[model samples]
Target: MNWRRLQAVMVKELRQMRRDRITLAMIVAIPVMQLLLFGYAINTNLRDLTAGIADQANTAGSRALVMDIVATTVVTPTLAAETPQQLMEAMRRGEISIGIVIPPDFERRRIEGRERVQILVDGSDNAVQSAAAQLAQMPLDAPVRTGPAIERAISVVAFYNPERRSAVNIVPGLIGVILTMTMVLFTGVAIVRERERGNMELLIATPVSSAELMIGKVLPYVAIGLVQTSVVLALGLWLFQVPLNGSVLHVYIAAMLLIVANLTLGLLISTRAQSQFQAMQMTFFIFLPSILLSGFMFPFAGMPRPVQWLAEVLPLTHFLRLIRGVMLRGASLWELWVDVLALLAFTVAMMTLAISRFRKRLD
Candidate 1:
């Protein structure tokens, strides 16, 4: 209850933190790094995606149509398949995002006033599938504009993100990064700070249980993380005009789960570290992989199989799916329940492990 002592400790900690060149440098450097990485490096555009073509119609007209598809800068034709089964296998193996299946009647149909084309698009890849579908129709749409065309265009419209904008897709992900960085980095170092300051014995003597003490230490950090997340998200929406298609309540709920999962992870790391410096190092080690493999900056599909599988194990992977699904896809909680459940499970298990380790430490 001594205000003077608390204030003295707070000021001393601030001065010492400021005087520590590494901490000061990190505070400034991390933000700059995040800004640069997010601003320039993160692009949602699917570029140079591999495509496969199974051409039953090897006529001149069919070749020209295939050529037009290959010409589109977005899709690169990597494989020529003789059968539909081969095309399906390639797509299943993730070797090609787009597969063009030209039927035997493609050339005959085009010549006989029937420009009907059968396009098989991979729905699993939203962006690449859209791109491929557009390319498939380009050859037909170019030369003809008549009765059914207007009706078809009106019916099967290709509106500019008729659902979600790139900004909306991206900003929600930034929320996850903010929560992860602030909650995990700060709380991970908390107990280590107590140990470094030789206050572990004093804290252990208090009546607070290890779980209660950990919660008390983590709650303030969680609040700070939420505040930062709100500020960044508001800036993204207001300044960039990002759309909010899904329920605001759902976004906030997802944020809460993500914060708890990341905070518990931080608490676990704090329990394992012997000093604040070591905790900070461990935090960075965890932070980099989470950011890189979280599909925040890079497409998870673009990575090698081993790398993609590695990312699947991280909570950030599931959390990113929840954020992007709710914000960009306008998905309901029902659709995102898997990600929500995964995060909830991760939080529970991590918190239990941290609390168990913390109780042992108290003894």
Candidate 2:
């Protein structure tokens, strides 16, 4: 290791590193990305959960009470329900996380020291459950400060996971996380692996159309993804005792859409990556945001408004809603059709984009 020779080697390595723009950019981009995500996007202390009000009381005191809850900023009143059943249905549909049902007898009950303000909490999200639970025991000491500081018991009913078990929330979401990790990792390197192994020439020489090749590449992974989903759901049910109260068909339908979307994303990454390392870097770039911002770890309602809009674009965000809505809430497919449509649209659009990119690369 002569000094001059070592210096020459170092210079050569620096030049090589400089030439790899993706690697160099990622070195800077990843750290900045992590900082932004953890600092701004990843918030565990959730606020502003979507809420509904069913003001059957129609009285000044009841209205005052509703205003008091809103002022707490624990929940934002976004929907209007005529009855508690309708409010519960809204929670089941994943529309709103909290439901305030002020019965017609609220005024009478308040005066009689029994104003049971029914709060229905969607307990499938642990962070949300925790935040909304505060509302139950929260001293409404100053909320209704019109008269003599009258305190009332909040009849908090946690629907879905009444126990507020962490597993109930985490297990269902694990399906999307697992699929995203394995499927993207597996397919992100597919085309790049071919290039690395000197099979690109053979692929180019073959008569297979780009569409056929793209289908052939991703089809096998679809089956594997479904299998992975089965294993995760089964383990979640068996080991964690997490309930699956919805249709098996619904779970698969959502899982398939997510699977295809991730695979296509991987394929798209494959089209751009010159090597497996680059493909992996690109995959990781997406993986972090998908987990952090997709409401898998943090509640979507907790994110800032702009961040929530950003989350809406992620496929995992929509799938989590569908999966949780089905497994925990026992919601019907039609009830969650908006999320269903979102996943379907993501799959179709991503698949088309991946195919076009692959064809362009092949050409």
> How many Å off is the CA of 241 in candidate 2?
0.8
- Please report the TM-score between candidate 2 and the true structure: 0.95
TM values, all candidates: 0.62, 0.95
* Worst-scoring 10-residue span by lDDT in model 1: 150-159
Measured on C-alpha atoms, candidate 1 has an lDDT of 0.69
Q: What residue runs in model 2 are displaced by over 4 Å at the alpha carbon?
A: 140-143, 146-151, 359-363
Model 2 — which ten-residue stretch has the worst lDDT?
143-152
Tens digits of lDDT, candidate 1, 47-145: 567767788978776776666555556567889998877876665444566666677876556655554344454443356545655554444435433
Compose the digit string of candidate 2's lDDT tens values, residues 1-363.
699999999999999989999999999999999998889877777788899999998888778878877877888889998999988888898889999988898767776777547888888887877887777666664646433232354677788888889999999899999999989999999988987888778888889888888889999999999999999999998999999999999899889989988898888889888789999999999999999999888777767788888888888998899999999999977999998888788877877887887752333
Flag clash pairs in model 2. none
Which RMSD does model 1 reach against the true structure? Answer: 10.0
